[model samples]
Target: MSARLEVRLDDERKQRLEQLGEAEGVPISEVVRRLIDDAWEEVMRARRIAAVERMAQLEVEDPPDPETLSRELEETYGPGGLS
Candidate 1:
């Protein structure tokens, strides 16, 4: 399903978007969709980075030992399960 949105852009911005669409051989709506998708991807990437940063700040008790993890993985999967 698709949703419809009516945005009111300034003349200059609308003209710029129109020109960009023309140059790219696509409709202005397509241009706007691409811009919105790119912005959404960047926002998701930033959120992932923030999550990693938060996890790094937390202290974990008895995190598994790397050697033990590797050995368990090797037994389950194959030798050098994860090199």
Candidate 2:
């Protein structure tokens, strides 16, 4: 139930796609389709992860103490913490 997709590529990109398809033992169209599918899966996975994180953040109960929270923030944003 997939529709046909017509794309215009520069000669160099076309050659590269052909070479990649040959190396992978698949048709160029299949290579493109797989790449697109993989990208879509990655995007969906990221969205799911973000949604879960947002839900967890929303589930927090009482507010953290300011001093403890500041320390935690300093620790998190300090030398050996998440960027």
TM-score of every candidate relative to the true structure: 0.69, 0.65
Backbone clashes in model 1, listed as residue pairs: none
Per-residue lDDT of candidate 1, residues 1-83 (tens digit): 88999999999999999999999999999999999999999999999999999999989887579988888899988895766
lDDT of 1 at 56: 95
- Over 22-55, each residue of candidate 2 has an lDDT whose tens digit, in order, gives 9999999998998899999999999999999999
Candidate with the greatest TM-score versus the true structure = 1
User: What lDDT does model 2 reach?
Assistant: 0.90
Clashing pairs in 2: none
lDDT of 1 at 31: 98
